[model samples]
Target: MSGWQRVLRGMLDILYPPPPLCALCERPLRHFLQGRGAVEEPSLLCVACEKQFAFIAGEICHVCGRPWIGESCGDCLRRKERDFLFSRSAVRYNDKMKELLARYKYRGDRKLAEVMAFFLQQAWRLHYAEMKVDCLTYIPLHEARLFERTFNQAEEMACLLGKRVGVPVYGMLERRKATEKQSKKDRAGRLHALENVFSYAPCGKYDLPERPVIVLVDDVYTTGTTVAEAGRAIRTGISGAQIYGLTVAR
Candidate 1:
């Protein structure tokens, strides 16, 4: 954050002392009290506001976790459905969530990530028992992107997750090819452009552990293109392990 922004936020923190403030509403909390040290858990969102970001439910697609009004989303209904076991994000990518995410991703708001990490940790606890992850890896930014941003948002999320879950995060995979942003492409274009873009390098600083199970971590899960392509490379080059995926958004 810039010097002025930090000063203002610091002032706010002192005056407000964080929560009981709603994570979604940004209001002082008088009830529903849980916090990340000072930053509150997203649970501070009042029940009425919480309903706007309903959890995924019913007849959802088996792969991408798209909310199904009837049977499945169009992409998941296609024959070439994604192969990863299903997925769930913490909350809907609503205006509030997107603004908070952009603050961390675009505006260098590290403090916001701490609050988000706790929220993500809650979601992980909610669903991970059924998922049973064996190993954990994160999608990496291309070297150029990493240098420009000075941090990969996925890596930041993974850092917090590693601390929360006590699972080691492998920097085993490398982004070998710099490509156009996935958000710029149609689904077919995104999938095609990602082919061979990610490479796995064994014999890193940490030795590969046994059983070979892993959860691929990333900050966003938009269309599932990045994780699917990254997982394919890992299966092809690394150990033949089942891959699970976790992210802050879908």
Candidate 2:
């Protein structure tokens, strides 16, 4: 941008200062709660607002990232096979998270990518930090949807995560089938819809690592079908691949 544009932006920032507000709840974050450590870095949400998010921690199902309430979640136990080693998410898909995602994704607010990626980084630290994650890649968007949305939310978050975590993000996957939206579908419908949806994209000169430990990134993990399908497709293209799933919410 030109210097004049930069100056104008600075003026605007001074006139209408960016609010130090929580992303989920528009409450001002400037007020530090009493007895809390004020020296700590400020997060995207205020203490009270942040408390509202149900962060996924403790014993979780390896397949679905849900709290292990039973011997094994029915979804993971019933499935005879899965391509990905495991899947995990940062937070629960609650109304607050949904609203944040809608603003970032549907409403074209790209700045929220950083906040979303912050949680993703935490998820990685909790789940995949010790694992040998060779490279990171994100779920692809079909051409039509890509054109309509103008930006891939998953890709944007993944790039930010890659930078934060020192992982090399690669564009090695593509959505070959523009399947129907899975949000409204039931488990069976979602499973059927995701079949053969992902395909491997050729990477020029970036030779595949031997028995690569790949982590597939996505915005949300409703059911494991999408990531499983993606893992299957990637394994088909690359030999001896171990796939894993990471998402912002479960």
Candidate 3:
């Protein structure tokens, strides 16, 4: 940010502050950190709330990468025979997590996206670090939705992660069809609705690197239809590309 822009934002922050302190913590961080120490890093959660929600654990499906109660979610154990069946998300879409995602995505809180990306990076390091990924791409927003929202939250998260992980972020997947919200639909309904909705194209004019892999990013993964369709496009439209997905919500 430029100097003037920073000054303006700072002024606005004081005038109309973003929710003071962490959303979960009712206590103000100014009070928490008072005389405790000088800070060298950026953090709002006085270490305890930060550490409590630090990581998402327990058994997760190898294919869909969702936290499961039993051995595996039905989608993971049975992916209906596809080239790219594996998928993963950083956190589950519980009530609290959903509120955070809404704040970042709809309320234009980019900093919240950055904090959420921290969890995403942790999930990647724990589960997907061994995968030789070539690039990161976000599940693209439709042109209409892109205009309506004025930003793509998934792409925002991807750019943050790409900066830290030392990988290129590409907007390769295109949304050819617009559909209703998946959150309100059943799994079969979602899978059928998006069958002809997405397509994959070349990342750019340059020839993609050899044995290049692609990681798809999205805000949420409920029914797995969106990413599955996008992955199929990558497998068919492009060659020699391994596809994966990273989502904030599962």
Per-candidate TM equals 0.76, 0.84, 0.77
lDDT of model 2 at position 91 = 90
Kindly report which residue stretches of model 2 are placed more than 4 angstroms away from their true locations once superposed: 1-42
Model 2 C-alpha lDDT per residue in residues 1-250, reported as the tens digit of each score = 7999999999998998866877656787776443212223457778887777788888788578888865568889998888988888999999988988999988998878888987898788877777778888889999999998999999899899999778888877888878887898888899988888988895654555799998999989987888999999888988789999999999
The candidate that wins on lDDT is: 2
Candidate 2: residue pairs that collide: none
**lDDT tens digits, residues 129-167, model 1?**
455565577888899988877898887788788887787
lDDT of each: 0.70, 0.84, 0.73
Better of 1 and 3 by TM-score: 3
**What is the Cα-based TM-score of model 2?**
0.84
Write model 3 residue lDDT over 1-250, tens digit each, in one string: 9999999999999998865666445566653322111323345555566644424566777777766677667766676655564777766677768778788877877778777776677667766677778888888878888887899888888999898778788777788877878778787888888886878766685446765688888888777777878887777767767887788778
- Score candidate 1 by TM-score against the native: 0.76
User: Mind sharing the TM-score for model 3?
Assistant: 0.77
lDDT of 3 at 83: 52
lDDT of 2: 0.84
RMSD of 3: 6.7
